[model samples]
Target: MAAPVITVSNKSLLHDQWQLLQPWFSYFDADGNPAVRYQLWDSGATATSGYFWTPTNAHWPANTTIDVAASDISNVWLRSGSAGGSETLWIRGFDGTDWSGWATFTFTTIPNSLPVATVEDQSLHVNQWARVSTLLSYSDANGDAATKYQFWDSGTAATSAHFWTPTNSHWAPNTTIEVSAADLANVWIQGGSTTGSETLWVRAFDGFNWGAWDTFTVASTNAKPVVAVADHSLHVNQWTRVGSWMNVSDANSDTITKYQFWDGGTAATSAYFWTPTNSHWAANTTIEVSASDIGNVWIQGGAATGTETLWVRAFDGTEWGDWDTFALTTTINTAPVATINDQSLHVNQWVKPGSWLSATDPEGDTITQYQFWDGNAAANSAYYWSSSNAHWASGIAIDVSAADLGNFWLHAGAAEGSDTMYVRAYDGTAWGNWDSFALTSTNTAPVATISNQTLNAAQWAQLVNWTAASDADGDAITKYQFWDGNAGANSAYFWTPTNSHWAAGIAIDVAAADLTSLWVQGGTAGGSDTMYLRAFDGTEWGAWHSFVVTTAV
Candidate 1:
């Protein structure tokens, strides 16, 4: 009989050494024999002691003889050796009367299987932490667990700047770490600041070879930045800066890009507001993507002064943060100033003062009133002219208003003596310092007389013995003057003394020589010639003194 056709099917499997494997084998006998057996060997064409397939026992027996029937030929089984290498099996089929040729089969056995990794995608906002191992997992075909792992950025191995810890600490790309180390080190991850998708390449090792790199996507979202502003104080006409009282920060280390401000109170009318470059902003405004756009702010003079609550917000190339408050206190207000100088006036004199009694207000306010007192008693109500009830005993204050200061008069009760007049000016808000002036009341005028004299037509009368002058108030009679007919210099010339008259020219000084030289000349046809005389008491002239001159024609 011809040898039965031998066919051995080889199976490739990842198994541990000394594990069992089942392979199918078949043969066709040409003589149509009912009994056919198969024999298997370990090497090429050399019948060494290996195994024989047995269908009833469902196992392979170690025998060099072909003791298995053709019915059990399909039940071929093999044993993986104790070591891994190129594995070969030699097999032959025999009929009841003829032996078949040996058939050879070749295959390889691996000692350890590679571990494969599967990574899961993750999604989170910026600044949130991500665990490394939580996104990575692996399995081995040889039933081996993952022993170590290495991760990289989206690109190939050794790529940097892909992962980081909460504190921003990072490991280099493709960094190898044992699975136990990953657990002990608490490795976390942080994506880039840009809001988008990120990729991480991961590979695992089962104490053998590393598997293929797998990737996990990290979807990042925008995060808002935090801002803080401190309280600020400024004068009504002063200003504060932006960075001086403001603090800007971010959680994801993002740059500050935008800012908005609010004005909580009335703006200064004259110089409303300004930016860093002194550019005026008629109203509150905002800036975007520019640094220090609002470097400083101005609070002009005469602005409303009070505690105000201002608002500000920030952006980190993302959404805006909550509105923060800036406590602003515009509390500086300078009081108005009033000015007055000392003055001098005579008794019984009503006169309007000059610029000496003027006032000024620092804030340009109006000066409302002035207070007058006696003897520098500025603070004493009893000595000052406050109302209708309190006034100077012999003085008066008039036209006390923003327009003018009319006059100040010293009336009847004022005696001839040295006195003081204190004055203070007032703006609408506050009173100015007191000012004082010296007042001098002069002595009364002197008296002049000429005794009655008789004269004939075309005749002269010696008046030296009749002329006299006196002064009251202990003043000396210093000068004397005479005029005819009480008509002053306009009267017809009826008196002669070297053709020099006292009233029309310089005064005649009181002296023995001057008095004896005085004479009265009669008119041509005069019943009684009236003459006037006056005297000076160094300060004032006394009232005119009249004397009658009797004339006969």
Candidate 2:
């Protein structure tokens, strides 16, 4: 009879299920009968006795009908345990009296299945720490209560992995772990020098061997600090309270430690360094900068006028951020001070006193206006007179008349008889303090004397030295008038002065016609003639005096 055909359904099973007969078979008995019985055993001689099949009861009755209609064998046995690897199952079937040689089938028993591993991507910044392993997952299909896992970088051995369970120790499936910076650094440094994109690889290992490596990119992210100033414009020598704000952030949540300041593209180290009170680097933080600080760093640094640039940067202990820039303009506005070049003036004089008024501004500002006062008075006071509102306004002409001096004569109480004139300047902003000087006014009249002289009646002799005049105020005697005893009768006989007499240096002259008129008025050439002489200054005339004139015999 043909050996009963035997067919096993599954060729492989887990070693843990070795005690149960999971394999199924189908066949017909050699006696043409449907009844059959079977047994299973290891085919390899080196195989352990555990691979031998054992029956709880004696081998089943040979006539037990192996139902052909049923597709599988139910009670095939392996009382002995099973080992993982290729194994052979030896089976024999029998009908009541006839025996069939054993039919052999080969199958494999697998060890505990390899643990499956997966990892997640991550992002971090320089000097920042994170748990990379927490992003990993592991699983085992064998249902092995104890499955071990280890972490490793790409191109690295599991023996030298970042972290692993103790030797011979195992962890349950789906276990989680946190990979530290030091643990990652063991294979590769995270966040290579710059701040951008990067990648990391991780792999897992079961207790016996390592699984395939899995890759997850680690994005290295870092951002620069943004900075700005409250005020971009400032004045030299002006004290201003300035503030600064900053926006700083890191992907890894790093803390900002300090700040640096820059002036004109150079670091403001040494005495110019500014320290902040608030350790927290954030927006709207008040950075108190005194006016003195501006003067020392900007104004004193030769940025007296125009705009200058300033820069700021933030430090996160390990790295320095990009520099943020701002602008600062320096300005100057100082009032001008004026002084009278000529300290004294003469009253009744049309003087260019304004030419004597000098002014200066510390900021080199142009003098736009000037005001003058007759006496010592504060500028912008009711009594002050506004001069020309033009550039160099202090250089205009001014008249210190007797009326002007007289007004101050009592107010000044000058023993030397002098009035004070005050002047101040304006440089488009405010007026300066008044500067003063003294002025003198006088009304002293000239004294005159008569000199005797003879003149020929018909011969026409010229009269000499008819009169002399002098004034203490250095005023010129402009004219002279003379008359005989009958002043109204000898009106025509009066001497008329010329241009030479109008000068302060020359004396008045008497013409020949005046001599003839004088002689005729005298009634006779031989008789002495009486002439009245007087001098006139530009403003007033002197007292009259009489002089004698004689005709030659």
* Winning candidate number (TM-score): 2
lDDT score of model 2?
A: 0.47
**52-161, model 1: which lDDT tens digit per residue?**
33545533443344455556555555544323455566677777777778877774455566688877887656555667767666678788767667666552233222
Tens-digit lDDT track for model 2 on 36-118?
A: 45544455443332343334443322223222212234544443224556655565655655545666666567665655667
Model 1 stretches astray by more than 4 angstroms: 9-24, 34-36, 44-76, 79-84, 110-127, 133-203, 207-553
Misplaced by over 4 Å in model 2 are 1-5, 13-23, 27-37, 45-85, 94-101, 109-127, 132-146, 149-205, 209-310, 317-322, 328-553
The clash count for each model shown is 1, 0
Every model's TM-score: 0.29, 0.31
Task: Give the clashing pairs for model 2.
Answer: none
